[model samples]
Target: MTKTDLRHRDVAEAAASQPMLQQVERWSAINSGSANLAGLATMAGLLADAFSALPGELALLDGAPSERVSASGQVLETLHGRHLRLRVRPDASRRMLFTGHMDTVYPADHSFQSISPIMDGRLNGPGVADMKGGLAVLLAALSAIERSGAAGSIGYDVLINSDEEVGSPSSAALLADLAPTKIAALTYEPALPDGTLAGARGGSGNFSILVRGRSAHAGRNPADGRNAVVAAADLTLRLAGVASPGLSVNPAKIDGGGPNNVVPDTAVLRVNFRPAGEEDVRHARTAVEAAAASVARDHDVAVEVHGGFGRPPKPVDPAAEKLFALVRECGRMIDLDVRWRSTGGVCDGNNIAACGVPVVDTMGVRGGAIHSPDEYLIVESLAERAMLSALAICRIADGGLA
Candidate 1:
């Protein structure tokens, strides 16, 4: 009846009829955990084919070799990973980045790879919510934009990184390179169950502390041995408090030490942290390094804390605030109520934003149970998200309200 009404009708027509759900199901069924290098390669190939088939400019960046060198000089050259980039329209000065990861937390051995049939209108799978569903939604929304004949109005670049689950060790450079040139970015990492978006995200870092201590006979000279496990335990306790104003420190895993007999000579502490700002991240790192050194000195052990902030914080800058406000307005235009919240949960978006691009991190459809068998996407939001993203793309490329 009216312009707004007609627009809504157009959005509905554009989104309601795609094989997008099938795409989601297929992707979710393939466990692409970064640890499963083989599976990730397969998924990357699949994504390449999908992108190649799209009626747009697409490029499959050559795989890069990322090596993990052990203390023993053993070099573990990880699988050569591929990243896909697809561009719609062209405006180099006013660019946008749409980021998502093709990798999930499920490994090749995980039993959560099955995509159950529609139950209560929800499809369940390993990555249905975590992100495979989001990828499908990306494709569907792009297709809808294509059909809307507004494709040329939205100049966007879609980047699907293959190694997000493992801290994105290899793809960070690409994200950085793309971020500096983009005006805004939308990361399809699913919204909350209530359909609220992720406002600002904390920066993330992964660290591992290896302690080396002298081992001695348990019964004969237990006192003569320096216990690396003890040093690690102390360090962990201290590292637990690294969370300050905008930082959170978490010692997730610790390993080493055989039986209770001989004094333990080795310990490995694996910890992860997230910061809300650059200073927060630096403070957390300082605290971690200080704690490690103190513990090692006190326990007569050699300790090493090696790692850096992998993804910098996507602070609540004016640009990001503008993005959220725009998306909210976009929701209003589509008759959907949308909200957002800041969180410590990091994603590829954080990595993207670190490159200085403003980004709305939760552009995916509302969903829950990410990384679990119970994962599901809210089917009702499929069209809502697609329309919102497409509309936003159009506005941004049109040089307004991005």
Candidate 2:
């Protein structure tokens, strides 16, 4: 066995059950919904306090600028709370990046708040699996490596963003800035229920197409009216048919319309699409534009399309596969089996991979039912995943894998 193997085993064994569960319970208690600015600010402070245990310069940097259309159709920009950044061993020969999110899908007022023990050694609650639990695992693994005195061999930055659950519109730029020249990346998005990892994620984009047309009194001059609502509906149907083996399109909702006596003059069609790769993304965009233009021309309306592909596809390149192999090796050392498959969902890993960085993003606790009230974390995987992550980092630090 290599010296790296021995050290990793020692660290993994010591790393488990080092207040990791308690930290999860504590952190999961707070509500850090993506749109809850106050809650996110408080959660950010809590993260700063918790991650301060590591050896690094910790800073709470301002979140990136993001814009959204208000209910009145006015475009407005909003600022989120600070995001956590910790730089450890900045001058080390090798560097890696670690990322996790502090936000959940549940709003502050949502009723799903408390953590309760479920059957089969699982804990059910909001954010327990969809990533507060993952953050706990990351801290435990890093603590073990730091205590082993091997942290200096591998430099890394831990980014805990407060806006990941909302497609990371604000944090995307921050990730791009930090991704250059990184050898590998680990993201603590929860593993699948059976502990399978996410590999080769498809890229995702969100779009809002606004339509404007001439309104008329339906009872008096129905022929003179151009219906924007009908135009939006036509566009939705056309876009849904654009999905192919390489692309998935979803027309989520439409907004607009009024009383029966009036022809609706304004409407917005909201959509989401997942593409297999860059070419797929390009094709999907072209298809959406052509469909929208056809609908507008037929309905005599003006259409404005907004938003583009924010998260790029993350394919399992050779470098990424090597990292996965190392993770599997560590899993075997700890008597854990690790499997992976391509995922339709996208995350921060997609953004990191777009920078030419190889990333294994599902390096977190095993769990299921994410983004729902039934979300849960397997109690045993807390320690198991921590060990796996610590061992993998140890292998990377020892130059066994790049």
Instruction: Give each model's whole-structure lDDT.
Output: 0.76, 0.89
What would the TM-scores of all predictions be? 0.90, 0.97
Which lDDT tens digits does candidate 1 get at residues 22-125? 77777766778877767777787788776664566887675566755354323367764677888766664576788888888877787776887787867777
lDDT of 2 by residue, 1-402 (tens): 777678778998877957888888888888889888888888899889888999989999998778765533456787776789999988888999999999999998999988986677999988999899899999999998898886668899999998998888888888998888788899999999899999999999998888888789999998899998999999999999989999999899888888989998888888999999899999998998899889988999998887789889889998889888988988999888999999998899999999988889999899999988889999899999999998888888888673
Clashes of each: 0, 0
Candidate 2's TM-score reads: 0.97
Error of 2 at 312 (Å): 1.2
lDDT of 2 at 332: 95
Residue 265 lDDT in candidate 1: 88
Considering every candidate listed, which one attains the maximal lDDT? 2
Candidate 1 off by > 4 Å: 1-12, 55-57, 62-77, 88-91, 147-149
By summed lDDT, the worst window of 10 consecutive residues in model 2 runs over 67-76
Model 1's lDDT to the true fold?
0.76
Pick by TM-score: which candidate is best? 2
Consecutive 10-residue window with the lowest summed lDDT within model 1: 67-76
